[model samples]
Target chain A: MKTLLMTISRDLKVAYRNPADVINPLVFFVIVISLFPLGISPSADVLVGIAPGVIWVAALLSCLLSFELMFRSDYEDGSLEQMTFGSGPFILVIMGKIVSHWIMTGLPLALLSPLLGMMLFVPPPGLTALMLSLLLATPTLSLLGSVGAGLTVGLRKGGVLVAILVLPLFVPVLILATAMVQTGIQGGDYTGHMLWLGALLAIATGISPLATSAAVRISLSH
Target chain B: MLNVRNLTCIRDERVLFENLSFSLGAGEALRVEGSNGTGKTTLLRILAGLYEDYEGEVDWALDEFPLYVGHKPGVKDLLTATENLTWLSALQEGQVAPDAVRAALAQVNLRGFEDVSCGSMSEGQRKRVNLARLYLTRASAWILDEPFSAIDVSGIAALEERMNDHVLAGGLLLLITHQQLQLDCAVRSLRLGV
Candidate 1:
């Protein structure tokens, strides 16, 4: 437990000192969100119709933008290997990293989504739903992305490979989260969608750290 | 407290080393000497359990994991020297006090620069920040790959003296280096790519 907290705090400290890393993805999220109304159509009807998907896709892409921050530096500098050989279970180290990655990228993006939803003309109910769905779903993005990041940490040009490997897994959360927002916009109960998203988060929280550790071990092997 | 037998590593379908074997007990230093691409680092990684694509038995009889300082040195550029040491020591479950971390940084000749972020330090200074772990380690064995590279003459002498003290106190040392040892203890050398 101490090891886990220490690793999380260490990563947080590093991320805090490097503010650019934390801020860049949020900037990407905002830019991507704003570009939709400009590029597609500025009409309120069209903008409101596409707001949930636009916000969710932007959030996913922004999370994707920050995946490199999770393990690349640690892998390059050999800290990941040292953590693997540490006294604590390697999964705890991975969990700490995943948590910190979410804190840096996922949490902030979720917090910033409501504003983007409003800009895109999403209704109040939909904006609330957008925020809630992101809060529950973005961690899954970070969790699942960690596996891809770990698998490709040793490779150059791993960003494309990680996107290819991880985006397919993200399809379910994207579908469910978008549905939840649409249902809210329609004044319908979206509790079922929320339950499914919750279950995905639970399973991802249960499994991703272990899978990431295995992938990391494979990459670390010479 | 370390043992290996019939260790053969084949990388990229080329045999780097085959049918190699060695062992080290407490109070011994083994220097892995070889030219570049001769698999010295590979051998160290295999022993350190960072590399697993090999056919052999490498065993540590001790309960504690060996302290390994590899080529990358694991220093984070955004972190201060003290922060790096504190977290690195925490990886091994070592509850290093703030004063001890300061002392370790000082021992590495980073006394006044302890709070400086590693990104702003020289390469040698950054390397020294990683080497500072030597002062705070609790493990019985040390596996160092090119520990002297990028370090100054006085820093190298300080490290040599520290290694001498470690081995004399019955700690095991497995190192890969090109520098000749000036330690008081007997040094065993192993050449790879033979």
Candidate 2:
């Protein structure tokens, strides 16, 4: 447990030292959402109708933008190799990394989402639903995205490959999240959508670390 | 003791080495010498369990994990020397105190640079920060891929003395290097790509 905490703290320090890494994704999220208002109609009806999908999609893309940072530096600097042989379990290391990545990208994105949703003229009732869905769903995003990050870590231009591999898997979460917000917009009960998102998060939390650890081994062999 | 039997590695449809065997024991230092692209790093990595695509039996008779210092050195540019070593030691489950890490950095001629970020340091300085692990590691075996590169003449001499001391103290050492080792201990030589 101490070792896992150390890994998490170490990763946090690394991420903190590079402020741009933490800020860029958030900026991308805001910019992408802002562009939707300008590119599409700025009126409340059109914006409210499309608000949930817009916020969710922007958040997803921004999260993807930061996945490259997950394991690339560690792999390049030989830290990942040492990690495999370290006394701590490899799964612990994977878990620590995923946790930190979510803290840096997913958590902040989820928090910033309501402001963006309001800017898009989403109904007041839907704003809470938007934040709640993102809170549950972005963790799943980080979890699933980590496997892709681990697999393509060795490639020179892995960002695109990560998107190609991970975006398809993101469909379920997207559908569930957007649905939750749409129900909230109509002042309908969103408990089912939240339950489904929570279930996906639980499933993703269970599986992603194992898959990522294996992916790291495979990437190291290359 | 470390034993290898019929260790063969093939990469990109080319056989780097086939049917090779060797054993290393306590109080031994083996220097792996080879030209570029001879799979010296590959063999070291295989023994370190970082690569497993090869066919071989690498039986490690010791209990502790080997301290592997690879070509990349594993030093992060954004972290201070102390932070890097603290994090690395924690990774290895050693958990050396901050003061001891500072002492190791001093031993590597990085006395006052412990708090300085590695990015601002020179290549040799960064390498010394990485080499500081040698002073703190308690592992029974050390697998180093070129521990002397980018080091000055005195640094190389100091490191050689330390390597000899480690071997003479009953620790095993396997290193890949092009420089002729000038140590007092018996240095075994393995010429790859013959």
Comparing only chain B with the true structure, the TM-scores of all models are 0.98, 0.97
lDDT of 1 by residue, B1-194 (tens): 99999999999888999989888999999999889999999999999889999998998898888899998878898898888888888788557899989999999999999889988999899889889989998899999999999998999999999999999999999998788779999889998877
lDDT of 2: 0.91
> Candidate 1's residue-wise lDDT over A124-196, tens digit each?
9988899999999999999999999999998988999999999999999999999999998887899999999
Worst ten in a row by lDDT for model 1 chain B: B87-96
* Model 2 spans > 4 angstroms off: none
Q: TM-scores of all models?
A: 0.97, 0.97
User: Candidate 1, residue B115: CA error in Å?
Assistant: 0.8
For residue A135, model 1's alpha carbon misses the true position, in angstroms, by: 0.2
Interface DockQ of candidate 1 = 0.77
The model with the greatest DockQ is: 1
* Native contacts present in candidate 2, fraction: 0.69
